[model samples]
Target: MVKKKPTNKDDNLVAQNRKARHDYRVLQTYEAGIALTGTEIKSVRASRVNLKDGFAQIRDGQATLMNVHISEYEQGNQFNHDPLRNRKLLLHKQEIKRLAKETDKKGVTIVPLKMYLKKGFAKVLIGVAEGKHEYDKRETMKKRDQEREISRVLKHY
Candidate 1:
């Protein structure tokens, strides 16, 4: 039988913060629109962005994305955006209110897990996560290792 090698995501993936998944137990996920400048758009098209260490904050009934890194556009001199800027996250007032209410619970957070261009518009996938205890994290790792081991066995047999 012919076997096909496993493949990762396409190279067009802009940025991902894997740690967010490990450190927090994601309860729900939301796709949010981001406001970007021209230079920021160019930088995103080049895949020059980072979602690591990025998070969403709720303030004054609004949502803001903090610590997202968008590299400077090479062709745009003196008009590039700040690499790490707090940008507005576009969501309905009701959604924002819901997120804010949920986030008020201790140890629950708004984490930006991914950034990518979807259907010609930039989007951020934010996770509403609750902090995981050390034991929980270890259990997750153990389960992942078991899955990997099972996959390896199946591949060999």
Candidate 2:
């Protein structure tokens, strides 16, 4: 029996929204700090975050992350933060203002794409994305399939 070493370089990635790519055309991406309680931070460190339904919204000139589920910490008794609570995103005022202005345009919104820890600080990658239509999604799928087929043919040859 051979033992394997734990050498996952991308293990720091807490969560990713795979559907975001298929459903939206990303225009821009921004990294923002997340405000978390002690227990919430612990949960995030444990990779207990879900970005599938997460999104960012600007309100009163501030950005907030909503629908990001962070499971409760096991050791947390009564001090655990709410799993689905809206958490504030740390961004400069200028950036917030720009995001607010850009989000006002039709079909453009903020979506959380990935979450990870950078230098021990929890950070989220949010994107300004435009929603894709059904035909656009189909076209993307077709392109991906063609790429896969080409790779297979090359390998066989």
Candidate 3:
């Protein structure tokens, strides 16, 4: 039996960090290309990317993605990429400087939100975010609950 390959649109998304939305107030978003080894790319295409517990930082004038897990490819032997390796993110020089400056501000940080394929190349969606306070989190939950309740009532009517 021949295994079927996933279609372009269906296989675009590799992973997402849903918790980032709930825990941070997003200020801005940027798309960056990830540097991945051959085996890692295969693993990502197999839907083995994980964005939870991941963050980005600027070091030595470069942006690096840390703690994002890309599992080893099953068919790859000793050439498999490390699952926990810090990956480089490709960005323009000015963008990297800007991110570095912004992240230096109190309560601001860089976070990876999602990984997806664009034109067959892997790309990451990163956000400039501020950590949400406890009360702010509560307010977000309340708003969400109200929205849900309103939708339910409208559907019933």
Candidate 4:
């Protein structure tokens, strides 16, 4: 008899870029597999990953993730991988072309919203986003505050 693996959503989440939604208006999101070295995978599983300041790009018909940091494994000596190296994202050709087209627009770029492990493999949720102006950000904050106030009032009833 084989033991079944427990499925927990939060447990699988490795890292998230909290500021991604605040700074940019995400238009679309794509789930792409990431290619990580042995040590890098080990570091990711240990929750030593940072998605802040990370972005994705399509170049030469390939999707690449950049600026994401996966801390070096403490147990890994000379074979440890570089933390800041650009890692390839495994996406379909159609998806790559779509992302490339979307990024070609002004003020539009690709950002990594979060990184998680799925089926024991590292996956990144990348978004095509446009920069949010100061006023837009303020509006979003105002709306959120209003919603919170409404919920609080309802709960008191």
Report the C-alpha displacement of residue 75, candidate 2, in angstroms: 0.9
Question: What lDDT score goes with residue 29 in model 2?
Answer: 90
Model 1 C-alpha lDDT per residue in residues 88-133, reported as the tens digit of each score: 9999988999999999999999999888777678888899999899
lDDT of 4 at 153: 100
lDDT for 138 (candidate 1): 95
lDDT of each: 0.88, 0.93, 0.93, 0.94
For 33-146, candidate 4 gives per-residue lDDT tens digits of 998999999999999999999998889999999999999999999999999999999999999999999999899999999888888998888999999999999999999999
Q: Cα miss at 35, model 1 (Å)?
A: 0.6
- Backbone clashes for every candidate come to 0, 0, 0, 0
Q: Which regions of candidate 2 fall more than 4 Å away from where they truly are? A: 1-11
For 1-157, candidate 3 gives per-residue lDDT tens digits of 9997656533588898999999999999999999999999999888898899999999999999999999999999999888999999999999999999999999999999989998888999999999999999999999999999999999999
The estimated TM-scores of all candidates read 0.86, 0.90, 0.90, 0.93
Among all candidates shown, the one with the greatest TM-score: 4
List residue ranges in candidate 1 displaced over 4 A.
Answer: 1-12, 151-157
Arrange candidates by TM-score, highest first: which order?
4, 2, 3, 1
